[model samples]
Target: MSRAAGLSRRQFLALGWFPWLRPRHIGLAGARFRILRNGRSLRRYLRIHGNEETARQVLERHMETHEGIAFVIESRTRVVAVESLQLDPNRMFSRVGAEANLKLLNPGVAPERVRRALDLLDRGREKLVRALTPPRGGMTIALHNNSSAYSVTAEVPISDQTSLREPGNPHAFFLCTDPRDFETLKTSPYNVVLQQHGPKQDDGSLSRLAAARAFRYVNLEVAAGQTERQREMLNWLEWFLP
Candidate 1:
């Protein structure tokens, strides 16, 4: 990150055109995430679900011209194979959620096996969480793609506050854990919800972990295949929030 090792303005511009840095893959347990970093920013971006092509594409495009880091799940499918069991990558953030996900469909799997898998996950999670955490002055933004069945409406029941700015576009909205971030986003021309507190039952999602640590976290969800729309919203967020 030092200036001596930094890319010049010319090189930075060319990086957008030619992509000098190929995304490097980082693994944890049985899951892998591809990391893309350009220049620097206090904030970090993420694509947690691999099947969410719209979110992944928009995030990759954003990394081309923006500063900060982005972590994307490597598999193109929603779940990854871990220890002969299907595991939801997002649920791997906590031991409880991971145990549940690993056992969800594989009920016949032994409890002893689940415990051993969780032990390995706990070790890997420590390093992964450290890399994902934001600095003191910034936050983490996660991009997701949801189906029409899931929208801001579903999140409203659990949210502390809501700003349904773009009511018609329920699939595209912002979910934030910090009240201050919620206040700022409410004024934007987009739907925003403030969770403000941890869920009664920690589902082991990244947002739950962020809230527990009091680290700022935001989720921008868009309907699938809306690549351009997600890009515009991301641009607006970066411009307005920055």
Candidate 2:
């Protein structure tokens, strides 16, 4: 029988593109479908900027053409549209750190070699986590609008230990707000914590700092208030990354 003819009604429904069509398939289909739909709607909304009524009309038209389109209208500046696709807990995205993602870079690198290195790194991290033991804490370092002041927030995981000792090792992550900053941090004295740098924005700045500072000092640049010479100053910080 032909493929369409052979399909039972349930199978036919499953084959359809709508994300909400199959509750059983929700786990597999949710995130990817939502991402695609959100990205498309965002592109459309961006295309019609300055014409509010026209934008709304256009959005309605697009949704009519494609079902399951949902908008996360957070704010005027931060809207994220998504589809009504639910995800299964088991299929959710991985929560690994930047180290894991870095292993995926380098186009010619063999997967097995990367995996081996990652496995070793993971073992080392686990050891550190164990050594840090009960009442282990996390730190958040925030750079000012310029490179002038950095604010650090440290929190401990509660346990039997009364006091949490800081991770004795000094670690630093670099955040280059611009291309020049990127170049600067690439050659600075501070050890590079994250293998990746910025094309990154505000919300990501902290995460990059956290990832990059796995060792001791982190290099960071604030795009909002950087000068030409300061950008060069950043490049001077790269010598520290191992």
Candidate 3:
């Protein structure tokens, strides 16, 4: 068997015999896809349109053919021939896991709105420093956990609440000094994990959160001054779609 086939077999065994494991059920003839549902890998087949071109055409047709079936297609492997055609929307959503939850926090909010909010908060950095100057009424802006050395005279007090919130609307932006801070902010009723500067976790952060299950965690690595650290941080976020 080829390496890909061997890997598939191993994945099948890992799924540990469940009714959903059958390929026909998921809409594929031979290819099998399984996801952990309630702690067990539930098997399902993805209806793929053979090769890349066909898949693209089918997906394009699907959107044009049907109204409101928005999707983004990413292929790490080249598509050749039309192989299958059983794409399940629910499966795709499940694949997104925690990021989906974050999106849900604010229903009906456009992506651009959230982007603007983040931009606003980032601009507030200068204001934050000015506001932190000379501890008036105990209002201050601290870094990670330390006080800012510089001080400025600004009437507006800087508070952490500006960038973070509980019961945050999906449209609101959340900020953290580091990925570790972000991971720690997650709470019950949502499942997301944010990790600090490190190699990408093997299991995909969303899958881990979904299985273990906690509020969504948005990992944001604070940019360090070192060029290499900043590069690594950007590279990591690049792999992740906002």
**Which candidate number has the best lDDT?**
1
TM-score of each: 0.87, 0.21, 0.17
- For model 2, give the 10-residue run with minimal summed lDDT: 155-164
**Each candidate: what lDDT?**
0.85, 0.29, 0.27
Q: Tell me how many residue pairs clash in candidate 3.
A: 21
| lDDT tens readout by residue for model 2, 1-242 | 38868889898867756654422211111111111142222111111111123223333444455332222121222111112221121111222432233333334556565555445434443332221121222211112222223311111121111111222312223432233333444454432223233223212222333333442223332323343322333334422222
Writing each residue's lDDT as its tens digit, candidate 1 over 34-119 gives 88988868989889787999998899888999999889888898887777677888898899989888898578898988888888
Per candidate, the number of residue pairs that clash is: 0, 25, 21
CA shift at 215, candidate 3, in angstroms? 3.5
User: Could you tell me the lDDT of residue 29 within candidate 2?
Assistant: 16
Cα lDDT of model 3 by residue, 79-189, tens digit: 211112222222222224322432444456576654543344334423322311222222111111001331111101321222223223221122222344344344222
